[model samples]
Target: MTETSKNLIAEYYALHLGELRAFVAKCTGSPADSEDMVQTIFLRLLQTDKMISAVTLPCLVYSAARNIVADYWRHRKSVERHETYVKSHCDCGTDSGPASVYAPAEIMQLLERGMARLSPKSRRIYTMSVVGGMRVSEISDTLGVAYKSVENRLGAARKEMRRYMSRMLA
Candidate 1:
């Protein structure tokens, strides 16, 4: 990378890290995912010579980040749609009526519907991990699965849930 680019990136990170993090978190719906996306954005910038030379470099980064976030949302939406289709095919059905959870009835209903959309195994894994507050090892033992399987399932479940929340809000 050029000295100018290094200086620019440093300046941007020093001055705008919090803002960028907040922006990415708002766009991506989670802090951890936003952190990953921001790292990816900067890495992409570092690798691209053309992008490094733009006069409006900061704006360009933000734009690119936005595009990335949009793409992420698109993929997430696709996953949710697939899950919904699978859910429809499965015996697990959603309740259109009021929910018993803490949120407003409508919001709770939507969350339940979204959770219902997940595969039965995924739903069980998620409930155990989140609601039951079980560790991966504990969940794996309880479910008679490996720790890695629990981790992978939980990761996918979290992504699906975030996507569901994003779609619900949007």
Candidate 2:
């Protein structure tokens, strides 16, 4: 940037730092989060050339700060939601615990071998429904097959997995 642009941004920083920090604190409800968000806001502003536009400086700074605050809250909310979900779903031996417990590696190996034994169509449908976590309707749409065909494939895969598990254990 030219010296003129550099001087203009420096002026913006000097004039707005306290107001920005205060605004962030009000929006975020925590001093530390506000401080971090304000830093990010200023950093983003400095990295861009928008500071050179005389008419857009105030709007740009405000918009950037708002976006930063919004993103922080959005991310914070998602993390909190995920934590609650994990806590609610966690089963350490409770009645609501997981129905079956298989290590990921074991499950992967079992799935691989079981799928290998299935017919190609059955394997595709089963993988889409179970491993890929696709809905029956989604699989039907993706494979251009009827829902009944998908259901049959899923049943066959489940039966095959059961037999495969029995053989492995035996």
Candidate 3:
């Protein structure tokens, strides 16, 4: 980078750092993330040879920061949608209304019967995850078992429970 360009960027950074941070923080709702984004914008500006010289520096930086914030929101929304879908499918009790085929009480009975049918290890893992509210990794660590083993046990338990519930509902 040329000395003049470097100096111009430094000047811009000095002049607009606070404004950019405030604007980005407002957009992203996170002061820390906004600070990182502001640094990233300046870094991008420092790397490009001609773009900084071609456009108004403040305008370019603000525009890039806005784009970053927009992308953050878009990515957050996609993750939230995915998490909602996964929770709805993976958890049986997430839905229990008039449209539900089985009443909550019947579902609880089925769950209890199904849990009773699980092997000892599987039952413990399932209870720890679903009832004790422990994460799979935490259960694995607590049980001194491999992470994959805990996951497999949980998966098998869920499948068996689903089958039992389906049969009872039918």
Candidate 4:
């Protein structure tokens, strides 16, 4: 920046540092957060070529600090909310958790082989119920079959696949 701009900013810093410190400290409630925020308010002036009016420097600097404080609280609140959700709702157990219950590629390979062994009609019904996310009643209506036939096929398909996955996985 030009020397003129740098000197102008330095003068503003000299005049406003204490007020900015107090304002930010009051806004955030933490001395450490205020220190960073006070520095940020001054540094933001470095990006601008225009000078703050001597008549309005307090309004200008305080407004910038207010915006920074708002953003800090907003980000902190989001992080706190995410941490709370994870603490209450997630079970991400240690290494032995459901997170590692399956090796994904291995499981997929076993599933593909088991599916290959199913009779085509059973496979179609199972695919509709599982992969296509269709209910048994929906599958029955779409395929013009009785709902009981759809349920039996779905049950048998699930039983066979479970047995196949267990035998292969074990």
Candidate 5:
């Protein structure tokens, strides 16, 4: 685009920034998402090679903001649906709600079996975090392991335990 077109866009963006932000917020009903959408709108404008006419810039900005809000809601719904599907199919007893299905006796028996199956390092890391109430950083410092290693082992341990519990319960 020409310098003149750039100047026009800059001026228009500067003059109407708040209106654009408010427009997105009203469209999405979320100030946080609106802020992101506003940035995306201007970033698209600034990066594009096509020259936008001064008269048409406002319409294009509003139209793009509307499209972004629609896309955000669509993506949000898709994610929620995916989560719902996973929750319905899997009874891993990872959280308190579904985990209540197992009686205390069954939970104890399953937990012991699960812990026994994990690698020694993973089992120790899991214990340090869960039983010892230690954070990942503290565990890493005490064990002289990388922070990520401690974190990863904790995740692996949990996954292993969950799989074992699920299999036993099934």
Candidate 6:
């Protein structure tokens, strides 16, 4: 903020830019990413008053750079892992797929039959829980039923649906 602080930070940047860039590049394995990270670290230094007042400027800079690169890698790895999971789980219509056994129309008909077989109360509870995305507690409150009663009804509904679906599929 002050002239002295600005000058000191400017001098530190001039002296350490190359070393910082090299260290970040080695860690990140990408020149462009390393350059960007180095700039981010210096920007952080400018924003953080404690960093500007630190006794060892180079040490602080290198430490901040390392931390930033480490965070970048951590974030990148997390994103890569999530992408892998999404790619594997997404329904892209491969031959070996969850829908391979039953056509969508057949499954829908079976589901309708199964739902029809449930008692009216059970069907309402099941629809509220599954189709309506209502939690058991919310359903209980809305229906003025006990929580355990709602759970029991939902369970019975699921069992009936499972039995009906099994018979239809077979």
lDDT of 3 by residue, 1-170 (tens): 78778888898889878988999999889998988888988887887766456357777777888888987798789779966864565444865555654566867888899999999999999999888967798899899999999999999998998788667765
lDDT agreement with native, every candidate: 0.80, 0.77, 0.83, 0.80, 0.83, 0.81
Window of ten residues with lowest summed lDDT in model 1: 93-102
Candidate 2 to native Cα RMSD, angstroms: 12.3
What ranges in model 5 sit over 4 Å off? 92-170
Model 1 ranges off by over 4 Å: 51-54, 93-170
lDDT of 5 by residue, 1-170 (tens): 77887788889888998999998888778998888789888887877787689888888888888888987888789779966865576665565574546677876887877898888899899989877967798899899999998999999898887678667866
lDDT tens digits, residue span 62-94, model 1: 987898899789879987997786456544345
Poorest lDDT segment (10 consecutive residues) of candidate 4:
86-95
- Greater lDDT among 3 and 6 belongs to 3
* Candidate 1 similarity to native, TM-score: 0.51
At residue 67, give the lDDT of candidate 1. Answer: 86
- Each prediction's TM-score against the native? 0.51, 0.52, 0.52, 0.50, 0.53, 0.51
Best by TM-score: 5
Per-residue lDDT over 1-170 for candidate 2, one digit per residue giving the tens place of the 0 to 100 score: 56776677678889988898999889988878887777777676677765466676778778988888887788789779966864564454565445444466876887688789899888888888776867787899899999888887898788888779667644
Q: Model 5: how far is 170 from its true place, Å?
A: 11
Off by over 4 Å in 2: 92-170
Error of 2 at 132 (Å): 27
Candidate 1 clashes: the total is: 0
123: Cα error in model 6, Å:
34
Q: Please name the candidate that would achieve the greatest lDDT relative to the true structure.
A: 3
Against the hidden true structure, what lDDT does model 3 obtain? 0.83
| All candidates: CA RMSD (Å) | 11.7, 12.3, 12.0, 18.7, 11.7, 14.2
